[model samples]
Target chain A: MKFFRNLTIGQYVHKDSPIHKLDPRIKILTSLLMMILIFLTESWWSFLIIGFFFTVNIWLSKVQIKYVLRGLKPILVLIILTLFIHLFTTPGEVIFQIGVIRMTWEGLSRGMFIAVRLFLLILTTSWLTLTTSPIALTDGIERLLSFFKIIGFPAHEIAMMMTIALRFIPTLMEETEKIIKAQMSRGADFESGNILKRMKNMIPIIIPLFINAFHRADELAIAMEARCYRGGEGRTHYRALSFKYLDKVFFMIISFTIALIIIINVV
Target chain B: MFIYLENASYTYNLNMPFETKALDSINLSIDRGEFIGIIGHTGCGKTTLLQLLNGLLEPTIGHVFIDGVDIHQNKKGLKEIRKKIGLTFQYPENQLFEESIYKEIAFGPRNLGITDDLLDERVKKAMKMVELDYNQYKDRSPFELSGGEMRRVAIASVLAIDPEIIILDEPTASLDPQSHASFLTLIKNLYQKYHKTMILVSHNMDVIAELAQRVLVMEKGKIIMDSTPRNIFQESVEQLEKIGLELPQVTYVMHRLKQMGKEVNSGVLTIEEAKEEIFSILKVKKSNNEIF
Candidate 1:
């Protein structure tokens, strides 16, 4: 009961490895390139190539295979459901039939291809998150988006918001747990009710969570002001990012992979 | 008897890869008017244990009985049990959602189906219990109040239901000393005035020492010690230290004095008692000096 609901987003596991040491900008670009290539490839063989590269990269990251798999577990049901729907419901020549249910070879292959693509996409994105700290990620994003500032885009503000939101994920999770325990002690029955009743019971928990979240936001704003935070205008980073030789090599490999996938699809 | 957990144990995310045993097999009973202090380090199952007592969590291996009936046995009875045992979580101010403090306090009683005059009376009484002035604060939005005031309003919201037992989990966490002291006094008044059974889960030894008649110490999902506060602090100082808990300041001072060859009892828990003991020792030393 205490463990199932502790799912937190953007939690980076600290480790000393090649992937962890890579420049955040390179990782971000690699992730984006992989996502683009994944969408570009329509053939099965290219997926195999991409999957092979993904497996090797994950292995090199030195993260426990189990932790990456754990992140995948939450999305497994969605992937399976999507595959089943795509395989059986798409109109095509019947490869197999069971009463009203019919399966087509094309649909089956497409389903498998889509599932694998989605799986790799999620896994690669998770790898980026697992390896890079949130601060570094946002810093890279802010720097990348700074180009848009010339066109009147509020890139710095957006980046600041993202960083703060990411920073509060764990704090808010801990607070939510405390609030739930408090309401539970008050005899709020959240577990054993019909859908409506359960939702009704959640009023106690959700209300408190929102209240606390806002309270925290207010306090954070004041604290920031007290510390002379003037919204990313004159801010200097504690750790300025520098791209190394490994970053260059990593980006070059990603570019090569994308080119190969695109060339295969075109041919 | 109001609540009873018979040989209960709870594990979080059972059968999952991240499974953890939050509470071990334990037996506990709370009468209608008893105040129980549950003390433990972080992750020691104090919060889990509180959830069990109020039937927010059904025991994985045992049953929770409220008013001589198992709460999980029937839906109607479970609702009643929830109404009977009101829990105020630590930093409860987060739960305030209504537009006004009055409505926030009235929320619980309304859920329990009380109406009209009785609801108003309960709201007013609950506000008074927490030392909130109904006239000044009731019409105000809870969101506008300071952290301490919002916390009191949150507690008032729960008290409106007139629960027989109240459970507070680290009620004074992160508050200034003045606010903490005032909040403690408010809770003490609730115990004395209404005689409601209270279970306070806290890591603050001073709060527990001042409030709890009986203390339950938990470590690694097990109740390591359950006794009167005096007994637990005096008899198991070494064990408590091993579990990352410290005795109250007065008790620590008394223990140090005893170690330094002074004729002083180490069981004293409050500053007032320590003052009397130190004064007597000083007088004795002065008399010896004159005789010399």
Candidate 2:
């Protein structure tokens, strides 16, 4: 019933910490590079190195670990399912057997590794959102994607759309919560229903949500057009993105972490 | 103290960087059938208080009791309490999603396990209570209705559950003049007809002055004034204004008359009442041989 309240997407917790001060482009790129390294990692030591960097970044972000972990709650089931898939599907020396299910030492290790990797991935991404405002994130994305303009990718528009979507997450959640409560007051039971019944029950909420969303989008488009929003073409930003000295230091730390991850994989 | 709040407080995003204390240590009580008006500036926690009443949001501290039972303590009872305390939120029309108006109104009572036989009767009855034509609009899509009609459908949806306590937050907001007047009249009629305990939260002092027997003024998540409308409006004009709230238009006129050295009753709410007070004063002055 209270699932959406703990939502972390597009939630920016304002802080004056170094992580919050880092250029959002650097944060985005560093996290992307770290994500690549995490997927490439083969050894436990590499995980430890990446984990150390993740933990340090989280600490520097000055966001509560509990708040960051709350974002992982929705993905907890995904992580568990991935672990079990790895544990049972991989072929290796069997260490335990129960009925049709067999567990191998290698499978167990691999499953554990995958679980850790998924957990770290979610953490890193959540940290990026927590430390950076949506405006900065959008600006950073637009700048990063600007390089693809040569290929004719409407980068500014895509970035703006993402930014709008992110900005509306909290508004939509608030709306949904209100709708749920309004329905609940009239004895609408969203919790206890069969799968189909639950989905059927959601019609009252989803329909209104969509209608309202469309209405809001229509209004927004009109407002934007009224304000002469020409979709980033010849558009200047109010707060320009500039990399400070700390952004360089942050890049160096993330590069070092990547190097360590590479060395651990090679050795 | 039929409905009681014991030092109740609510904070959003607890322990997070953006945590905010929406309601702060609020303690108040409402009798079974009292019409209570809650007035506050925007973001003053009026809506949060309404949500807490029906157990939509639990208090971060203290307890909210309905009929002497702590609602949050028992899961089964909380659902029952929620059924009894029906809340029609601000911009209620946006909550409508059912294909037909009948199903939309029936959604509430159906959730309470009312038999299908009773549901048709209840929905029809609730629609009638809101002055909507059950036979005409029942099969019609809710989205096809005008804004005011859609709002009534939403309110009827809440009313179908036969809640003993009805809470409305800014019910007349964003309505046309004619629609707002009728909407308030409909609410007033429903309250009188059912004798339901009603809690109305609004920024319109005139509406609150007209409808509410008792008024609760909130500021910074606290109940700064809780008194009868007459008492709160008549004497606390300056204080209320300081909190960014104004007196009802007629009451403001009375305050102005009093400042102009005319002996006008400051407690007058409606324009009719103001007229009566002014006439009475004029009659007295004429009998005393006062010059015009």
Best by lDDT: 2
C-alpha DockQ of every model: 0.34, 0.63
Identify the leading candidate in terms of DockQ.
2
Cα-lDDT of candidate 2: 0.88
Question: What TM-score number comes out for model 1?
Answer: 0.77
- lDDT of each residue in A18-113, candidate 2, tens digit only: 999988899899889878877877788887887888788788778888778888888999999989998898899998899989988888888999
Clashing pairs in 2: A186-B108
Off by over 4 Å in 2: A1-3, A11-133, A242-267, B15-18, B115-117, B284-292
Cα displacement (Å) at residue A54, model 2:
6.0
Model 1's CAPRI class is acceptable
Model 1 agreement with the true structure over B4-75: per-residue lDDT tens digits: 788899998778767899988988877777788988899999888887876668788988888789888885
Deviation of model 2 at A210, angstroms? 1.3
Weakest 10 consecutive residues of candidate 1 chain A by summed lDDT: A181-190
